[model samples]
Target: MLLKNERISEIVDGKRVIVKKPELLAPAGNLEKLKIAVHYGADAVFIGGQEYSLRANADNFTIEEIREGVEFANQYGAKVYVTANIYAHNENIPGLDDYLRALEDAGVHGIIVADPLIIETARRVAPKLEVHLSTQQSLANWKAVQFWKEEGLERVVLAREVSAEEIRQIKEKVDIEIEAFIHGAMCSAYSGRCVLSNHMTARDSNRGGCCQSCRWDYDLYQLSDDGREIPLFSENDAPFAMSAKDLNLIRAIPAMIELGVDSLKIEGRMKSIHYVATVVSVYRKVIDAYCADPDHFTIREEWVRELDKCANRETASSFFEGFPDYTNHMYGTHSRKTTHEFAGLVLDYDRETGIATIQQRNHFKPGDEVEFFGPEIENFTQVIEKIWDEDGNELDAARHPLQIVKVPVKRPLFPYNMMRKEN
Candidate 1:
């Protein structure tokens, strides 16, 4: 195995591009989002339990829900990793053993952790469970990597501060799997272990309940002529010091792959199901295409275009090169791009004719132009040329949610392809 795909930018047209088929690790903030991630092509997914997770704000799974989710993921041949990455008070450390026992019983493939004490606790309590070091550790050197490997950690989710070249160097020196944040939001703090939130609010990010005060708009004050801190004002009142844009690597997956990355991780613990589904699906198509045939990754421009629906700051190759000039972020932001509502996707279409059958999602009106994403095809335009309800009546458009509609597609459509329109 090549281990990872090359960055899509290095593609020379007509020249063969080799993809190493890196493991695509998507995020699952909730069960609904988990289903979509797995359905889209996630090799593995990471979700947080109800307690002791960095993303306490997310709709995390309950114990029973996690068990069901593990079974559901296994049915689709995807592995599930659970997060237990919280700094423990000395008083509560005694009870953590029970928590790991419960998690191991639930069939979680691995547990992501931060504190070294917790790693030691897990080895004693749940020795069979794999341990993935959370980025909170902020480990960048071979010493830390080797140390963790000695402690029996299987994977290290490296800090975003380290470049891909550093990871390549570390990989050469270490034996553990390196999972990097190929795409996602970034924290101004080192590996997201900042004291700013604790100083402002009582919540500590290391303790799992981060009141994301990082995203808060702040004013920079400096001692002025009078030796007093003064605030400057702009004509338009908006956050001027927020340096972080969302991290998006849609265009650079191939490059990250070339770095011998073991897994490409998408980071969004508080994301919505719609966001997870759209992103995971698009990346799934891109990775699968690259894996099945090297040429497929280059032929489709629509993959990145489809990403515009949930596109972040839109970056590529941030790992190998020095951190992009824009990498240092003050405020963690979200996707500004708005995708259409949960609309139907095309299941299949008759190649000989224009007839199409859609797996319904949301209702729509006549004359609505539905964007169709076909397998192997870059982009397609199809208007609601005609609508046939299941009743066989010619309707203007779907009026109810999940209402199946038969419409005419311009080109041949396939199973598992998607068709959606903005609501």
Candidate 2:
């Protein structure tokens, strides 16, 4: 990865000053995830509505959910940006206007869009809402940033392919704000402009119907002129040919902030609430640490360990360097290597009784030791002396999904804190 100490000069009274710390952006597929994200310390959350969203498979928010999510985020002093990032067809325009107006009424802080027509429509229909240019447009250079700025974009999510030097240059040239994918899945194709999903699954990748064809294991083959198929590799050699490693810039936060990135986006709207909570919490800490003392900033090993506990694939700094080669690609089986799994979330804590009401997410026995962690408190592990259901029945384990249960905790705990058990 590019670990350069590049700095931009700002003429403040003929003196240079670095920009403010970037916002730690997180993804929220639904209202529950939105709550988890905000509670976990995300400065801003990006969500997709029921229509015109790229992640169609995600449990996108309904119009009412959007209103509720906006309100929920506002309470935390965090911003909510709704996605209207679909590459729309002619027939999608009429409903687009309605959706934009509804989002405006929902009180969203901003709209993330990709298409020029949609951008123009948002400018006309919901002028009060801030318009953010999505990464789907693949903005790589200063000129493209300037063009989007001229076209009236408040911020642009820079193309994933842009290098660190290019990002610095773009910021130096364009007066508009810049957002970059600091952490998340890296598309094998240019910022998700892949045609493979469309060709193989008849689902347009550009339209948000990507089936993740790249992550599938495949065997190499070659066709002869005589129409005979020859195997290039044995079945044992079948590999995750196009699976790219997940993007992680935990160690590069200070460097990226110095480059003037306004927002650092975390991808994966289809991820679980635990994933959103874990990733956002780590990034939030790193950003705060850096902003507090840039000169004395140091990357925390625990922050990296926390991210690894939730990442689905191996982590790498994609294209933030120059061009990534085979190192960026995961060649074997695609899998997550988490040392622990989410056990449950603290629903309510009874301080007088020294017990916490939790909604179980995974199986955990009464004797099993688990760690309790949250946004502000230090993580501590405690043995569960007893696990009782909501009806007050003592249980050997809390196994049911979303099962309300009470577990004894020694230290003071609060709602939204996470519990995790060793895998």
User: Best by TM-score, which number?
Assistant: 2
Supply the TM-score for candidate 2.
Answer: 0.92
Which consecutive 10 residues in model 1 have the weakest lDDT in total?
Answer: 1-10
**lDDT digits (tens) for residues 1-423 of candidate 2:** 112343332445544444466788999988999999999988999999888889989988998999999899999899999988888878788788888989999999899999888898988898888999998888889998889889878999988889889998887777888898888887877754777888999998877788898888787778999999998876667553878888988887878888778889999898888889889888888888776666667887888888877776888888887788888888876886688899999988998999999999999987898988898678889888999999999998888999999999998888899999878
Q: Candidate 1 residues 186-253, lDDT tens each?
A: 66567655877678887777776677666777776678898998767554645544445556666666
Clashes by residue pair, model 1: 6-254, 6-255, 7-254, 7-255, 164-319, 244-329
Best by lDDT: 2
CA lDDT, every prediction? 0.73, 0.85
RMSD of 1: 5.0
